[model samples]
Target: MNQPSPKRRGRFITLEGGEGAGKSTQVEGLKRFLEDQGIALVTTREPGGTPVAEAIRGLLLSRDHPAMHPDTELLLMFAARAEHLRTLILPALEAGRWVLCDRFTDATYAYQGGGRGVDPARIAALEVWVQGPVRPDLTLLLDMDVKTGLARARGRSEADRFEQEAVEFFERVREAYLERARSEPARYRIIDASRSVEAVAGDLQQAVSSLMGTGQGT
Candidate 1:
C-alpha cells in the first residue's frame, strides 16, 4: 500500500499599513529576499487576486464615486475578500507555498472600522466570516506617522479612496492598527517605517526571519 505524503500547509504572511507606508515596496523586497533563500512563495493582495475580487477592488477604489457610503465600502471590501480567500488564498495555503499577502482583513478594520467610523463589532464579524481559519500567521505592520506617510502617499499621483481620507481619519486608522498589534502581539509585528527604505527593509527581514524561523535562506 502506497501512502501519500502529508500535506504541507503554507505559512500565511500579510503586510499591512496605511497608504504610502511603503507596503508594496517592502513586500517586493521581502519576497526577493525570501526567494534568494530558496523558499517557494506566492504573493497576492486582498480586495483583489481573484477575478471577481479584482472587479470589486475597482468599485472599492474608484475615485469617481464621491458619495460612496462607509457601510457600502465596508461590505464591498468584505465581499472581495470572501472571493479572494475561497479562490486564491485558501488554495495557496493548502499547496505548501509560503503566501505573502499585501493586505487582508486587517485593512478593513483599520480603514473602514477606524478611518470611516464604522462599527468595530461589524468589522470583526465580517473578518471572521470572510477569513475564517486561514488568517495570516504573521502580519507585518509598517508603522509610520500619519503626516509623513500621507506626505509620501500624496507625492504619488492619483490618491485612492483611502488616500483621499483626512489626516484625522488615517490617524484613527493608524491607532486601530496599533491597537490590534498591541492586542495580538504574537501575530503582528510593528516596523517603524520612518527610517530609510534600506533600514526598514533590514528591520523587515529581521522580523520576517524571527517569525519564519530563519532568513528565507539568504
Candidate 2:
C-alpha cells in the first residue's frame, strides 16, 4: 500500500476591529514581516477575496441599502464568507501558505450580533455550518474607544453602511470584540490601537515574532 501523505497545515491569522483601528496599516506591515521570515502567505479580506465575495462586499457596504434588514445583512456576510473560505482560504491553507485575512467571522459576531442585536446563538450556528473545523489560529483585535476610532475613520474617508451607524452601535461592537478576546485569551491578542502608528506597528511586530518563534506560521 502507498504511504499516506504528511499533513501540512498553515497558520490563519485574522485582524479584527472597529473602523479606524489601523488594521490596514498593520496588515501591510505584518505581510512584510512574514515575507522577511520566508513564510509563504496570502493576504486577503473578509466579505471578499474572490470575485463573487467581492460583489457581495460591494452590496454589503453600499450606503444606498438603508432599508436592508439586519438578518439580511448577517446572511449576506456569511454568504460572502462561505465563498471566500471555499475558494481562497481553505485552498491556500491546505497548500501550506499562511493566510492573513483582514477580518473574519468574528466581525459578523461583533457587527451583527452586538451592533445589530442579533442573537449570538444564531451567529454560532452559522459559523459552525459555514466554517466547520477551520478557524483562525491567531486574532489580533485592534481596540480603541469608539469615538476616537470613528473620528479617525471619518477623517480618512466617507462612512460606509456600517460606518455610518451611530456611535452606540460601534460601542456594542467594540465590547463584543473585547468580550471575545477575554474569553479566548490564548487565541487573541488585544492591541491598544489608540496609540501612534509606530507604536501600534511595534506591538504587531512583537505579536508576529512570538507566533513565528513558535512555528505557528509554518
Candidate 3:
C-alpha cells in the first residue's frame, strides 16, 4: 500500500509599522531567537526579495526623479510584491520553512493609501490582485507616535522619499495600521514600540510565541 507523505505546515510572520518604528530591530531580534531555538526560518524584506523586486526598489528609493505619481508608486510596490511572493516567499512556505518578512501588503495600504492619499478602493483592488490567498499568518504591528518615530528616523539618515513625508502623512499611516489591526484582531498583534527596546522585544517575542502555540521562555 502506497502512503502519502506528511504535509508541510508553514507559517508566515510579518512585521508592520511606519518608518523608524523599530520594526527592523524587532524582526532581527525575533529571527535570531527563532533560529537559536532551531526553528526553520527564512528572513527577507519586501521590494527586494527577488531580483525583479530589487530593481523596483531602486526606483522607489531614487527620490530625485522628479514627481513620481502616487498611482505609479502604488503599482510599483505591488509589482515588486507580486514578484517577491511568487519567487521567494511562496516557495519557502511550501518547503515548510517559517518566513519572517519585514513588511507586506499592509505596508502598501498604509503608505500609499493612507500616507500618499491614494484611494483605498484602488489599493484594495491591487492587494486582491497581488496577494490573493497568500497572506501573513501573523502581523506584528509596531505601534508608536509619529513624531517620535520620525525623530528616530531622522537620526538614522537623510530621510528617503516616503520617510521625508509630512508628520501628518505618517500619522494617517499609523491610524491605517491600527485600524487594520483592530479589524483583523485574530491575525494582528499590536506591540508598543514606544517602550524600551528590550521591552518591545519581549512583547514581540510573546506575541509570536503565542501565535505558534509555544510557551514563552526565550
Candidate 4:
C-alpha cells in the first residue's frame, strides 16, 4: 500500500490594526506560542517579506513623497502584495507551514479605501486579481482609539506617510477595520488593544487555542 501523504496546506493568519496597536510584539508572542504547539510556521510582514516587496514598502512609507497620488499609493500596495503572496506566503502554505503575516489586503481596504477615499469596488477587484482564492483564515484586529494609538505610535518612531495623516484619516481607517471585522465575525477576532499587554496576550492566547482546537484540517 502507498504511504499516506502529509498535509500540504496550512492555515493563514494575519494581524491588522491602525498605528501603535503593538502588532509586532503580539506577532512575536504568537510565533513562540504556535511553535510550542508543534506547528510549522512562517512569520512575515506586508509590503515586505521579499526584496521586491520591501523596496515597494520603502516607497510607500517614505515621508518625502507627500505629493504621491492616492491611486499611485494604492497600486504600489497591491504590487507589493502580489510579490509578497506569490514569493513568500503561497509557497510556505503549500509546504504545510502556517503563515503569520503582520498585515494583508484588509489593510488596503482600511487604508486606501477608507483613509485615502479609494473606491472599495476597485480594491475588491485588485484583491481578487492578485490573491485569487487565497484569503486569511484568521485576522486579529487590534482595535484601539485613534488618538491613543497615534500618540503611542508617534512616541515610538517618526511618522511614516500613512502615520503622518491627520487624526481624521486614522479614524476612518479604524472604522474601516471595525466594519470589516463586524461583517466577517467568523474570520476576525477584534481585540481591544486599550488593555495592558498582559491582558492582550491572554486574549491572543485564547484565540489561538480556539483556532487550534477547531482543527480545520489545513
1-218, model 4: which lDDT tens digit per residue?
Answer: 22222243788899999999989878888898899999988999987889999999999999889989999998999999988888788888888788999999999999999999999999999887887767888899999999999999999999898888899999999999999999999889999999998899888878877667565534
What lDDT tens digits, residue by residue, belong to model 1 across residues 58-135? 888888886899889999998888777767776776776788989888888898888888999998777766665446
User: Which ten-residue region of model 4 has the weakest summed lDDT?
Assistant: 1-10
lDDT of 1 at 106: 88
TM values, all candidates: 0.91, 0.94, 0.91, 0.94
Please provide, for model 3 over 1-218, each residue's C-alpha lDDT reduced to its tens digit, 9 standing for 90 to 100.
22212232567899999889998777778998887777789999986788899899889977785489888998899889988887788777778788899989989888887788888899888777776656788899999999999999899888787776788889999998998899999899998899999999988888877656442211
lDDT of 2 by residue, 62-116 (tens): 9989779999998999999988988788788878898899999999989999999
Better of 2 and 3 by lDDT: 2
Candidates' C-alpha lDDT: 0.82, 0.87, 0.83, 0.88
Regions more than 4 Å wrong, model 1: 1-8, 213-218
- Candidate 3 worst ten-residue window by lDDT: 1-10
TM-score result, candidate 4: 0.94
Measured by C-alpha RMSD in angstroms, how accurate is candidate 2?
A: 3.7
TM-score of 3: 0.91
